[model samples]
Target: MCTAYSSDCPPASSALHGGPAAPPAAVAAPVVSLREVSVVRRGRCILAVESFEAQSGEFVVVVGPNGAGKSTLLGVMNGFVRPAFFRPAFFRPGSGGPGNGRAEVLGCDMRSFGGWRVRKRVALVAQMVDVDARLPISVLETVMVGGYGRLGLWRRPGKALRELALSHLERTGIAHLAHRPFGQCSGGERQRAAIARALTQEPDILLLDEPTSALDWHAQRGILALVADIHAERRHTARPLTTVMVTHDLNALYHGGEGEARRTVPDRVVCMAEGRVTWSGPVADALDAERLTALYGTPIDIIRHGPRPVVLF
Candidate 1:
């Protein structure tokens, strides 16, 4: 089911090829694990997941209708929100065997799971970064903020950290706007800067919340390309970065601009509805039109726009 967006999609690796079968390598301990996780706000249950796990270096995409808890899931990963009763574990880079270390959120146990150090290793880029462009900071300085977790309380960014931030800005294709006030750039530029900030941390896991939301068509395409580039560029590293992105735009799951030359789908997909994980598996099987229509409560048609599956009402 190839489409015009194939270029931007993930390669046809085994992870994208088969149904929901586990990969043959005897799955390593997941970088982040959740069990019986549930979130309640003001006595109203907003999110819940019985069991979830993301392997190191795998790309997972979360999608669902509005208010489906997609963003809440990302918040849970980095300890921004507290859950009712769930064991969330992180498998640190050099940690022992799978499930060897367990630390509560905001408190360091073994391997510093919760604390300032953990924040440095797990980067979360939320859509809120785009809402307030009047932050009164230059793009370069904004990116440097990502390093604050690593810098701790006393250290300034210094020369080396600034250079690293510039490199990431360049990688995300916004180096030219380094000195520009972040409020002055376009939506795309701000989103790129946000990504650059996240990359500055050199995080082990990157959690993105609807990076392409509220942008024009061109900007949306550009942001998705930037994400694919980040994933591809880090594929060969010893410890590749793992990413979990939440998006409501289903088209991003597949389509890309003409002649873009790179297309990649997520290795897995998690679909939510009314605060619970209704489906969790490979993107190929999880993105059925009928299934999504049920998930979104609208008539969704997965049509072929000259070879691609276009999921829309």
Candidate 2:
């Protein structure tokens, strides 16, 4: 957590004003910050966040029931969905002036900098997308498209780019399927390919929208493990990647099945409901049965499994 001064503290007087100079406080800026952000569609509000922030290199998992606005929050982070206050008048049709709020991603003001300008630095692996079975695009080719955002329209991908794409495919454990048609791969393989494609972008921020949804239990476990491995691997790099994943699977916060040992977890978890953040804190604190029950509007029981609590609905 970032340290912040209390509102009761007095403002520091400057030396130029004939007062002793106060030492500058050291505070790291958040990679993602939003205040009073809201998304309205067809005269209805879908997401409304009073304030949110994610420090650099932090892994945040968003969990909520269907229609709780979990995916909409991710969309706001990735700049795909502009806030009601930030949308242009033309985009809103009959709406008057822009709404009120602030959205900053990687130091760029989302209101003016625009999503396309920062998209190259932000890679998003959205939910599973069905592909035509006869499409001729190879898995390797599909992954290489991630780099096109940075390449722009004039430059063509060369040998180096192709090699980089292959390296990511290998890292994702899909090297053998590199030459296969993307549409032919299974759900798990396609998710892996999607991740490889996102990695090829060399993103600073990674946004995943239900990468494990619609898959079998085995496939879901594989995808979760893959995500954990990717997060761990990227943490050692000079520029550690910031990851935000949205999932409805509560068990994902732990490593194994119900009775298995829980060894890994994200830095934080944010619970959303009715277009608002109901809770945000460390994994341990956010997993309380009562808290979750209230958020999901359903009975939620937590069973103690050794040192970790497993969710039992």
Which candidate tops lDDT?
A: 2
| lDDT per residue as tens, model 1, 100-215 | 22323222221232333456578988885434556678999989998878886888779989999999999989999999988889888889999999999888789999898888
* lDDT, residue 10, candidate 1: 35
Candidate with the greatest TM-score versus the true structure: 2
The lDDT values for all models are 0.74, 0.80
lDDT of 2 by residue, 30-102 (tens): 7788877788889888887767888777889999889988888877777777765544344347877655577
Q: What is the lDDT of residue 74 in candidate 1?
A: 80
For all candidates, the clash counts are: 10, 1
How high is the lDDT of residue 285 in model 1? 79
Candidate 1 yields a Cα-based lDDT of 0.74
